[model samples]
Target: MVDDEDLIAERTPLPDAIGGRLREQLVFLAEVDKLKTVLRQSPLAAADRRENDAEHSWHLALMVSVLAEHSDEPIDVGRTVELVVLHDLVEIYAGDTPLYDDAGRESQQEREEAAADRLFGLLPADQAARFRGLWDEFESRGSPEARFAKAVDRVQPLLLNWLARGGTWRTPGVTADTVRARKAVIGEASTPLWTMVQELIGEGERRGWVSPGE
Candidate 1:
């Protein structure tokens, strides 16, 4: 009988025009293209919906450029940008789960981990491992880059809530305290950004766009 390994190798012919790795890359990109439909922070946009994953990823890349100067510590900015871009790609499979939804957050963590495995698994082993590591690192928020990325992630939603949608705080039943609790992490990361967020939230309260603490 033929050896299993040898038989498998012989049967698995590579693509003609490009290497198997590049073929796998094309497949991965084609899969990720669906990110154009995965929406985040619903109803917060004046134009089209807040943004689908493709736009969200692009916005995160732009964030690295604008927010780099505010990093509390030195970071590998290129790596940080990579982290931001890859951070939400898993949401394509898992969907956009909000921080305020505690039940959803827990479920999302498991779903996203699985999504990362499949999505990043497309690359050759080394590149896959590196990208997956960045995704995990950003999720953990342990390193300076991850923390900075988290801060920006939080900032973006708040900006959309207030600036983009003309203080969406008016959404019924949302309290100032609830918003503050949701935003407390940004406060921990960068005081300046947190200060701006606070002012925006306060303005919403003053305008009766949102209710005071319960």
Candidate 2:
């Protein structure tokens, strides 16, 4: 075996700043482990249950295809698409908070904020801030782009629950009134989408595709 002095002479060292950034990147990678856990636990279909952040981003991008015609104003299709995709990147940290959980929302927000720092910190600075701004814009839901993105985000799950065999709401544990409350708000973004939601809820309920409590 080599002596201690010989081993020390051969050691490779990282510059301090470089090593620190590498540690930060590794921390960001840890969020992927949590995603594997979340996807396996289904709020929607087991097959459709994407890892929380992935699903949110996917459906929002899809909004452009599904929702373009219904926009009241001329939406910048490119900008709105970007908003949806970036909006939920923070779910990588905060986990998916179901919309109806009014009581737990405040607590969830705090956890999500912490998760944001660790997850976004992985990116080079400019990109991280750009994404963080998109997340903030989506949350505020004040602008035309933000409002549309929020609307589509809300619609994706509703459609998924209705479309998936035994969609989450179709089970006995959830209620029809819950459906009304949830989809009712979709009207804020698109009147046509809101109408489509009301009809689908009725069809699902009457056909016994959805259960009583649901």
Candidate 3:
């Protein structure tokens, strides 16, 4: 009988045989398939299981398209969508670092930078540079699109937690104050969304879904 390793070897093309940009594109696509396996801390709204990076990225992309009007400034929706998707591709290698993990946050940038180099390097040079550029834009939050992308990234989990009745907010030491502090950047992208966030926090505290404060 053929063993699993042998089957995998048969399915994977020899590097020398991958002769063109299309081949490189195929290889990079295969590599990013691993993103589906990278689980995140937030639970799904419609499911009992936690979400994965691929799902989170897709969700953020859709949010950008649907909520572009809410942005504090006009944004390029297409560019914002690109930022959301490229932003988390690094997590395929670096893994999801929870927002409240102090120890994890300390090394998060270093780990993600390394992951970006290795992961994006799988693509052809031009494609790699394009992907890396968008990823950096998302990280730096320098442009209007980038800031709005960052805002939606934080908002997704907040919406999920509120909907899930204290999702990650139930983590030890998390309070309404903590959520507000971390998520305040959402205001930088959209004043209306920020107001909505405040309303949600008030409601969450009243319903005992989140702690009042420290």
Best by lDDT: 3
The candidate with the higher TM-score, 2 or 3, is: 3
- Model 2, which residues run further than 4 Å from truth? 1-37, 40-52, 100-103, 171-173, 211-214
TM-scores, all models, native as reference: 0.85, 0.72, 0.92
- Model 1 ranges with Cα > 4 A deviation: 1-16, 43-48, 164-173
lDDT for every model? 0.75, 0.65, 0.88
Residues 62-102 of candidate 3 have per-residue lDDT tens digits of 99999999998999999999899889988876889998887
Model 3 stretches astray by more than 4 angstroms: 1-11, 14-18
**Candidate 1 backbone collisions, by pair:** none
Better of 1 and 3 by lDDT: 3
Highest TM-score against the true fold, candidate: 3
What is residue 10's positional error in candidate 1, in angstroms? 22
| Per-prediction CA RMSD (Å) | 6.0, 7.8, 4.1
lDDT of 3 at 128: 90
Candidate 1 residue lDDT tens string, 117-196: 97787777888899999999998988888888888887777777775534445555568878888888776567788888
Ranking by TM-score: 3, 1, 2
Error of 2 at 141 (Å): 0.7
